[model samples]
Target: MCIGIPGKIIALHPQQADCAWADVCGMRREVNIALIAEGDRQQLIGCWVLIHVGFALSKLDEQEAQETLAALHAMEEVEADVAMFLGAGEKR
Candidate 1:
């Protein structure tokens, strides 16, 4: 399954504004915001976006982004538990 992470646009490219820097899960990375509307793009300096495969699929409200982040955190917790269990039990 393709996972899309919610992030906030922190910075934009000076020369080519197609791609901008986003703060995702506490980490900053370059993301493409070309898919969104030009009006929105023009004022996306502090907006949340659904980042998928290095591209910004769409813009999201702060509330929605927080909800998605909560879900993602829950899923991550489950994955970490599974990894720990697998590591504890060695394969033959």
Candidate 2:
């Protein structure tokens, strides 16, 4: 399933209007921020953004970002457990 991940904007390429550098979890990468208006672009730096398919869909506050990240981490743990269980079943 496609999920919107929370990422923090770390840098901006003003020369390049559509994309900016973002820190998703611990990894930094370029994310398209074209969905947001040019006037608001300056506010994007150091802000939390909801990302999907390499694009920033929306901006979020710090609290919401933290909560979303925690939930995602929990989901990841559940997925890992399921994979381990399936692997063990296959070996059995």
Candidate 3:
């Protein structure tokens, strides 16, 4: 049930040794992106990436990320409705 949100890589620095600064909703945060390959670097910077457990799990295109987020949100809403409906039924 761990959730990973999308962020865009902004900068890379050797100081962190294996991490990069990524922006999520305009808030900058350092996330480990050492998994990316050199040739893929350009594609990543300014593009959405799926982050998890302090690391970048995978790169996500804009459309895919939006669809994923929408699906996750819908699942949450459906689960909540089911819980509420079952609880109310039990009270009747």
Candidate 4:
């Protein structure tokens, strides 16, 4: 499934209106922030937000992001356990 996960905005390029840097988990990536309006833009930096199709869907708080990430991680762990239980090879 194609998903837009929550990421924290880490940097911004004022000279490049749409360009911004964000961290997905610990991986940093560049994304566009052009959709966000003038006054609201600054507030987005250092905050968690949802990104979809290279656009910012909505802003989220750190606590919310943490919870969501935790849930996703938990699900991944469960899936891994099930795969191991079924004797599924890494190549499978």
Sort order, lDDT high to low: 1, 2, 4, 3
How accurate locally is residue 63 in candidate 1, as Cα lDDT from 0 to 100? 99
**Ten residues in a row with the worst lDDT in model 3?**
83-92
List model 1 lDDT by residue over 22-77, tens digit each. Answer: 88766677788888738656589899999887899998999999998788777776
Across residues 8-91, which tens digit of lDDT does each residue of candidate 3 receive? Answer: 777775576578777754557678887764564545677788877668888889898777656655665667753332222111
Worst 10 residues of 1 by lDDT: 83-92
lDDT by residue (1-92, candidate 2, tens digit) is 56787888888876798899888766676789999646867788999999887789988999999998788777776677533322221111
TM-score of each: 0.79, 0.78, 0.62, 0.68
In order, what lDDT does every prediction score? Answer: 0.76, 0.76, 0.66, 0.66
RMSD (Å) per prediction: 8.4, 8.5, 10.5, 7.9
TM-score of 2: 0.78
Cα lDDT for residue 86, candidate 4 = 24
Q: How big is the positional error of residue 68 in model 2, measured in Å on the Cα after superposition?
A: 0.4
Better of 1 and 4 by TM-score: 1
Model 3 ranges off by over 4 Å = 40-43, 70-92
Kindly report which residue pairs in candidate 1 clash with one another: none
